[model samples]
Target chain A: MVSAAGGGRVLADQDVCVGAGQCARVAPGVFDQADDGLVVLLVRDVPAGEVDAVLDAVDRCPSGAVRLGAPAGGPY
Target chain B: MTTTDPGAATAQPGPQDDVPDFPVPRSCPFSPPQTYAGVRERDALTRVRVHGGKHAWLVARFEDVRTALAHPGASSDARNPAFPALGAGEQQVAAELRPFIRMDPPDHTQVRRMLVGEFTLRRVQALRPEIEAVCAEQVEHLLSRPQPADLVADYANRVSTTVICRLLGVPMEDLEFFRRVTSVSGSRTATAQEVGAALQELFGLLDRLIDLKAVTPGDDLVSRLVNGPLARGEITRTSLLSQIGITLNAGHETSRNAIPLAALDLLRHPDQLDLLRADPSLWPDAVDELLRHLSVADVITLRVATQDIALSVGTIPAGDAFIALLAGANHDPAVFDEPERLDVRRAQRHHVAFGHGVHQCVGQNLGRVELEIALRTLLERVPSLRLAVPESELPMRGASAIFGLDEVPVTW
Candidate 1:
């Protein structure tokens, strides 16, 4: 199942999930903790500018649990 | 555990008798006055006469030990002539396991660099929420159980083993198998046959995992290591296997012991538990203090002197073997104030529980995060957690390199 991180942006299991909680700990405004203490995405469509923090979160997942999906309007 | 000196009492004073005089910390088990009377009475670093070999110098001072650990003159290679066990057959085994933590600068640096990316602070912090959730779920289950549960078996060991398994990308179904292997490997008297069997099983498992990642790579560390720069021939398969084995061995056993040991310590001092619960911010510092008070790995990695070196304690001749006692150093009166007293709030920035220098534990940050999550979750979930048996009756010392309870039975 997928969840949102912030700005209503969707995060699938492979995207925005590094298994680390830099998002939950540092950017709690956009992330919430699941019962298992893992960060659950709370926003599904974040703006482009917010991508930096999300990427930082991605950089931190020890297991590399995060991936950024191409935006819909990107060059085919 | 006593041995008489053969040549010391009869012949003229030799190099063995001229042992250095490093002040042994009072925290050493050997330092207790009633435990080993004659040995404790001498200077901390006094040379002990051995029946089979010459007298060997002991480095008891913390700074001296750290220096020895980092010095080029001190070799992790067991082949040195002065190493106490040279007469025995410890060289071959030591040679095999000493690569990352035992070797001198250039070699140690190279091996460590290869694995350093896996343990970066950023990488470790990413596992926080997962680790926290695991701890919370485990503690919740423990809390729901009937009174008088085996905390060590039910909680600590499971939590540690699970985290380590996840980190290594070991199949969930295979965890029990690996846990069994790890438990046997860490036993005090594991026979050669048993160790051989365990290694075979572990290597078999790793081989399968490597193959699985090759075909269907996952986001786990193993897959990254296999398919990333390491896979392009930057690091050898044997080296990766060795690094994986070391990580698993260290990550599992150390955390397994630390969780229960810290639990027992808190249960023994309810006030500290209350203090921690009252203020969750104390969790990080509490973990450090727990590590110091219960310093899990009692003995630091062994170092053999490659050349003669003089220190504040005394002179250590070339090619001698010495053990750095992390437990002793943590409790050294000079380093810690009121060393024996357990203060969860103590500002303990430096503790040798995780050795020092190039060989210092790579996974220590992960370890600290694991401990913090486990302790905080336990406190929040099991408010009344207390020892089921008397403190004295609890088994505190294990037969392995790590010291912890055989089992911690507790009641809410």
Candidate 2:
């Protein structure tokens, strides 16, 4: 069910997004948060080196809304 | 899935009475508690006893710690009946305030939004020149004072205290009173009642300040809140008070300790200092690395599981409490290679030092900017700075949630 979009997916599940901004903090180039504090995608084709930080963001997200549907190297 | 009553949540899956203390003692100042490292090696999450014999799972490994904090089932509201209190009477204070720190979702987002713009990188950048000026003034004060200046008092305290006071709109004359009153709550040895009383005193002071801001709005944070959210009926007066109180606590404490901690670490590793001095661009990255390397006073924000969830290591049933041990996570070997050695050129940007998720420190951007400016100014102004006393002899702060120093005696 979790698959990549384009080269990879930067998924922010709307309901689960709590907007703790961990995603934005970890990979600001790839993620951002709205005023209501929900994670927003800045860029979907996440760069290669930033993948670990992106995963770190998805993992640390207070609400667990983020996911690597199609991580650059492989599936998360 | 097992379920328990709120109070029974304190009795989570664990050996009833045999884990090491919550603020695990460190063998040396820079090292993570030996127990924490042990836990990280054994399991991603382990239950341990906190200050008041409260049992909560300790999420140690980097991935698991992040999983625990960001879990949908996890809740930070200490009032959540199930949430674990760090110490005696902590629940009372936490629940009473129900500040944004304790609130879940919508309320947390809403309350935090009211103050977010003030701390964004852009905002903190705009405030940098002023912070630099303050840091310069404090450095001058350190230079002028008697030899072997207490860096904690002359530099760290003066810089952070003055900057925060100005940001919060405290009158210059009242800064000493507010600073002294605010620190009473950070006392680890103090009883919960004593800390509560101190917080109440802070609330009262904030109340008067809020009232003044209400009548005559100023450029300060409290004034902005009074005129924006409170006046708009978006947030209650009590919520505003809690926000201000928590801000006052976090604003000064993180930097007050961090500036000194980073300085101490840099002094100990003069080679790293030389690297940073050679290339000033390394300051921001170095600051981030230090924040990760130094977990000043633990910031494992406790959360109660609202439902059963498999936490990689174990399944935490509904109503059990757990904390995201940033101190432990920062050093997880899986995340940061060779987590120990102080390398200023290190480039890992993501750290839970200011915390993560919607509940991350609101003032983190400000904290970072302050550190960057203050440290840069200090190194530039006082190139010969060194510890005045033996590092071992320097007194560390007592058992407080946020670890800090009593005095950082140093000299140029």
Candidate 3:
């Protein structure tokens, strides 16, 4: 399988979430950490404009899990 | 940890007492610190004293400078206790917070590749129309303001900030906040407390903005980062935040200075300015020439010798510090005929102003785009713009590693 460094990193909130959504705070529209802590992707492919934000997400991932790939997950 | 001079490392030794200081104040603001001319002449591995009396080899010749930056044995890791600082003292910069420029290999490579893709030739070309719009907007804004405004603030800073903010996906509403934080964080005289406070404000702001993006990601760089790989757990939140912190500043700082400095050079050399205006096609080359001539970056980041590295100057022993004085290297007559003169036609494409090697400025294409647009727009809109104050009276950024005017007042 070809390696995909990172596609657009998004937030997926589970029922365990407490609703303190910070991901939505840093990146609105593309991600939404809803009240009650439901995180969801606003879009699938990274918008042409939001590439910088995606890169920022990689740097900001507190969990140290954010990947650095393009949207659509093409070969890096 | 111990004091050594670049001269001491050289086979030809100057008197120990005569060890020249690094980061010496420039006698003329247009050039590197005055001492570099002499250092460049020696061209051999020479030791120079830095803050805390530590020594670093100064590389000046163009070819040699490029070699040093590209060498694997020379490391950019600031975490190394002996890593040289351009500031007066080395302070503890947390590891996770260190910018990608200060990182070495695998880590630097990984982070840089991610960021580099954002500034590819195609990406920058795509950004041209937006960059031009910023330039036009700033010029119109300047025209509407009273005569004799501060171009550095009104035009240069505004255009650069706008381009960088847009390129990095910073919200337009927060431009003022971004501007204030960047200025404060980069201030040479800012106290630790002041810097920390400003940093705290920025961090808080980013966290809130990031959370917003988490829920409703937009078409911005930050949003892309946050929504993409961030969801996949390929990188870390701390890393993303750290990169944003650095990008917020790096994105604007160079062009902020370069646009005005290049303008000043042109204004002083009216013939060159006239040549550019007369032949509009030359604007792109003029920008490149200005980057080469002004070489506004005082020095490349300090590198530590990971192993004994030999060069034209001499051998840099393992653990020794090294820096390439780009200001001097850009002037090496070997590289350009009449390097001191601002020849808009100069075709030299390899200037190290944006630096070289793996650690070159990631936003350079963006910077160039801003510079080209800002310069052309300012000239076209304010054809008669001239310095409102005496050049000698203008305060240049002092003793700081970078070279820039604090302000450039202009009248048209």
TM-score for all models, in order of appearance: 0.73, 0.86, 0.79
Model 1, residue A52: distance off in Å is 32
**Model 3 misplacement above 4 A:** A1-76, B1-18, B88-91, B94-96, B174-176, B191-193
* Model 3 residue B28 distance off true place after TM-score fit, in angstroms: 2.7
- Per-residue lDDT for B214-243 in model 3, tens only? 898876778887887677786788787778
lDDT of 2 by residue, B1-412 (tens): 1223333344543554566556666666776777777777774356666666767777788877777766667788877766766656667777877877888877786777777766655456678889989998989989998988887778887788788878878665644554575466665456668877888878887889888998998888888889888999998888888888888777887788889888888888989998998898888889888888887745548888887757666667777788777888989888888999877776665778877666777787688889888888888999999988877887776565677777888878
The predicted structure with the larger DockQ, 1 or 2, is: 2
Q: Give every candidate's TM-score on chain A.
A: 0.55, 0.73, 0.54
Model 2: residues >4 Å from true position, as ranges? Answer: A1-76, B1-16
Q: Please state the interface RMSD for every predicted structure, separated by commas.
A: 11.3, 3.8, 16.1
What DockQ does candidate 3 score?
A: 0.02
List runs of model 1 lying over 4 Å from the truth.
A1-76, B1-44, B48-56, B78-94, B97-99, B144-146, B191-193
True contacts kept of each: 0.00, 0.22, 0.00
- Determine the backbone clash count of candidate 1: 16
What residue pairs are clashing in model 2? A3-A69, A4-A70, A19-A37, A20-B357, A20-B358, A61-B70, A62-B70, B297-B402, B297-B403
